[model samples]
Target: MPYALTCTLHLRRQVQLLSILTVFSVIKAGHVTREGEVRWQLFNECSQGMLQTYLGRVNTRGFSDRHCLTEFHVEADFYGAIRLQHAQSRKYLCFNKRQRITLRFNGDSERCYFYERINHSGYSELESAWQPRLFLGFNGRGRFQSPDTYHVKRRCFYWLKFVRYVPEEELHHCEIRKPVDQHVRLEHTNMAHNALRNSLLNQIRATHDGPYKHQDQENRNGTYSL
Candidate 1:
């Protein structure tokens, strides 16, 4: 073989190896820390809402009166595989055989696992670990939809933000005390529920002056259920 041809072949092999490494690098960039279990609110990037689990069903909502349904226990591995369990219901978020996202009590099954693919901007795409090709995404109507497309508009549905979950009591305390650094206002998010609860409690305390006085006391002591 000619020396020039041999050199050309070597260069091509190097280029092919580099391309393979680049693809791996992109996948590795999404690796989540294998630390202890953490709580998170799955914030959808396109829908601009949080993922909620209710009665073994899954959907994204702008705001919900039941805030606990929006929180999930995130157990992530080094390779980005995760298991999300609803904090309130203790149900595992699973992708069913029917290609739908659902919740079940048994979390040990393979269907409960999801592989996280986070991008440079900290947005994550959760692909089903049972079927890696299928992604946990949402439709335009903010309903759960497992996307099977390889390269067509995946970000609009699959991309999400794993926001650290903060308890409503702490948020409410900060708002009541009027913290200087933190701006306190209710928008179309989870915190809005707290604000509404407070408003209802205040109304109960002010309007009920007769037989409901005991209920007013409970409201003042923060034991009120609205």
Candidate 2:
């Protein structure tokens, strides 16, 4: 009987040990699952933040295929510059608002000139002509405040450019002329017109259906009367 009793005690102890180990394993698994959930939440929050920063308040209707003269205003935290080009005329104009400077480019051996005051006689002429295809606008480094902060004196400038090309037609009839320096205040005009153009293009891509689908639909609907 004493031997049986000893055996029973041993069995009870083994069962107790097993129960404790099982509980520990369950706790560890719960901890791992909780950590994974926390990590996923963090990643989701970060992605949303980035999306808000870049894509928030984007203009939806400003994208189109028709080319025309356009103006824009630019405001950045530190420094800003504007570049404008007429698609048809090939005229290139640039302005540096922070530095109070302007650059004009004509497709000729006549090198580009830089000016301090827009219309002042003390304009500094650059030895090299302005290259619209190469360096059309100003390049500077600066930081931006979060969307929550309001910038009262955020440096603002106006930019103007013309687009004259149709997608299906050759660009031979385009006549781009460089803009002469004027004291006009075109606000938000400091953005490179080319950049805004590309943004417009991206907006179209984001919103419109692919060309193939449109064409396919047209074909199916017998709208291609060609």
Candidate 3:
């Protein structure tokens, strides 16, 4: 074979391999589905609790705690960017100047957005869109990835799994919700976790005060959407 032809073929092969890698990267960087009212429940394995909003502060709470507060309406575009709004307060999640995750009434701010990346282990990590270096994690906690740090086998605290939470009353809309499972599942077998997260938030207290009063009223009217 001519030397020139051999060189051309080698370059062409490299180009093809690059194209394939690019496509695979796009596939792995999954995007958020915009199906209406499809909420996502964020569970932190280390904390063993669900991420919930309370009085505009973000924290993890046990499953038996304020249930609706744990659910969030995630809005996203085709590029894997997401914004989370508390299911009850309708408040969007945002990071303050101090890097603390808090709730805000407006979702338009850049601080409210996050870029989600799913690890090969099938768990997901959320990094702030406004401040790329910072990630969502427990307040005053979270290790930042850096050149000096060595990767470890244990899961990082910032890594959290999103579980789909659908109320039994919405069973009629199951078909509409199916499309989002692929992104939420990410090849991880969390059937038991899903079952526990999907349990209805039926234990809301009657004497619940503060923000609970507003949510309780909305629940009673059965008009709450998202």
Q: Which candidate is the best by TM-score?
A: 1
- Which stretches of candidate 2 lie above 4 Å from their native place? 1-66, 71-84, 96-98, 101-103, 106-168, 176-226
| Per-residue alpha-carbon lDDT of candidate 1 for residues 1-226, written as tens digits (9 for 90 to 100) | 6778677756655653353233222233677322233356776765667788765568776454345767676665565577887776778899788878788889877889987664444456777889867777776566865475435766555554444434334333212233453333334554778889987877766444633457657778888744
lDDT of each: 0.63, 0.28, 0.59
Q: How accurate is candidate 2 locally (lDDT)?
A: 0.28
1 or 2, greater by TM-score:
1
Give the 10-residue window scoring lowest on summed lDDT in candidate 3: 141-150
RMSD of each: 17.9, 32.5, 22.6
TM-score of each: 0.51, 0.19, 0.49
What lDDT is reached at residue 53 by model 3? 70
Report the number of clashing residue pairs per model.
Answer: 0, 22, 0
Error of 3 at 82 (Å): 0.4
Judge candidate 2 at residue 8 and give its lDDT: 68
Question: Which TM-score value belongs to model 3?
Answer: 0.49
Please tell me which model should have the higher TM-score, number 1 or number 3: 1
Looking at model 2, report the run of 10 residues with the lowest lDDT sum.
Answer: 35-44
